[model samples]
Target: MTTILVTGGTGTLGRHVVERLRQDGGNEVRVLSRSSRPYAVDLRKGGAELDAAVAGVDTIVHCASSPGGGDEQAARNLVAAARRAGVRHLVYISIVGVDRVPLGYYQAKLAVERQIEESGLGWTVLRATQFHDLLVRLFQAMAKLPVMLVPAGVSDQPVDASEVAARLAELALAAPAGRVEDLGGPEVRPLDDLARSYLRATARRRPLIRVPLAGKAYRGFRSGGHLAPEHRVGKGTFDDDLAARFS
Candidate 1:
């Protein structure tokens, strides 16, 4: 049986990945996290805990990340530990448009991708679009204001986190395929439309204001730099997700 370690196993995407891996059977799965849950190991600190997690693991699905900050250091530490343990494969989960988008978080993800590439270990990097639940949460936060401000000309192909997790599990079991095809949602929808849908689903009425943003990040999104139209591999749509959650 192949031994696999999954960092951020408690997270949204990581949780799904772990669930799928366990369902597949015939594999020993370990979860790396700060909590004292079963098979949990702290990966932020590259000491004995990290080493113990990496040691004897045939493959590592690296889903642990801090998009706001500290992602690069976390990846670096993990890569170092993997190398020390002589890991056979290291799979990393990254966001779509990390290279094209000008956001600081995207920049951090891109930096980690580069670190993994340079690590000289067998690796695969899968770049997926924003999760449907994340977009819902974004709209929920925006709904707090009297007037919901939506970024004009911005579009997203929000994929299901569970679908991404299944794909990651498939890649982890297979041989390392460096930088595979990008994974995207079933449809590309405007952010404003998504917000309107959310408001309608929740039966909340609010004045929607479309504000044209002026920044490199906004321009990138407006220009469809974050979209992968040809890679619409996901079967779930935002509307379907909303209907399941709210209907």
Candidate 2:
């Protein structure tokens, strides 16, 4: 039986991956998280805890990330520890536009992707679009205001995190394919439209006002840098995600 270690196993995407892995009932799956839970080893210290978490693991599905900052250091520490532990495969989850988008969080993700590539270990990087739940949360936060301000000309193809998790599980079970095809949602919609949909679903009436953003990040998004139209492999749509959550 293959042994798999999933970092950030308690997180949104990582939990789904962990669930799918456990469904097989043939592999030994462990979670490396900051919190102490069942089958979990803490990696916050990043020394012996990290080393012990990776030791004897055949594959490491790296889903742990800090979007605000410090993700690069986390990735470096994990890669170093995995190397020392002789990990056979490493699968990383990244955003779709990390390479093209100029956002700080995207830059951090891209940096980690580069580190994984140069780590000299067998690896696969899956770049996925923004998650539907994130968009929903964003709209929820914006609904508090009189006018929901959205970035003008920005579009999004929000994929379901569960779909991404399933793909990650499959990749973890297979041989490493470096930088596989991007994964996007079923359809691309304007960010304003998405906000409107969210408001409608929740029965919250809010006027969505488009505001032009003058930054490299907004330009990238407006130019569809975060979209993978050709790689619309995900089946779930934003509406479907909303229904599942609310219904």
Candidate 2: how large is its RMSD? 1.3
CA displacement after TM-score superposition, residue 189 of candidate 1 (Å) = 0.8
Off by more than 4 A, model 1: 36-42
TM-score of each: 0.97, 0.96
TM-score of 1: 0.97
Residue-wise C-alpha lDDT for candidate 2, range 1-247, written one tens digit per residue: 9999999998989999999999978899999788846445534347877888788999999998876677888888888899999999999999998989899999999999999999999999999999987898888888889889998999999999999999999999999999999999999999999988888788888777999989899899999999999989999899998888876
Q: What do the candidate models score in CA lDDT, each in turn?
A: 0.91, 0.89
What's the CA error at residue 172 for candidate 2, in Å?
Answer: 0.2
- Clashing residue pairs in candidate 2 are none
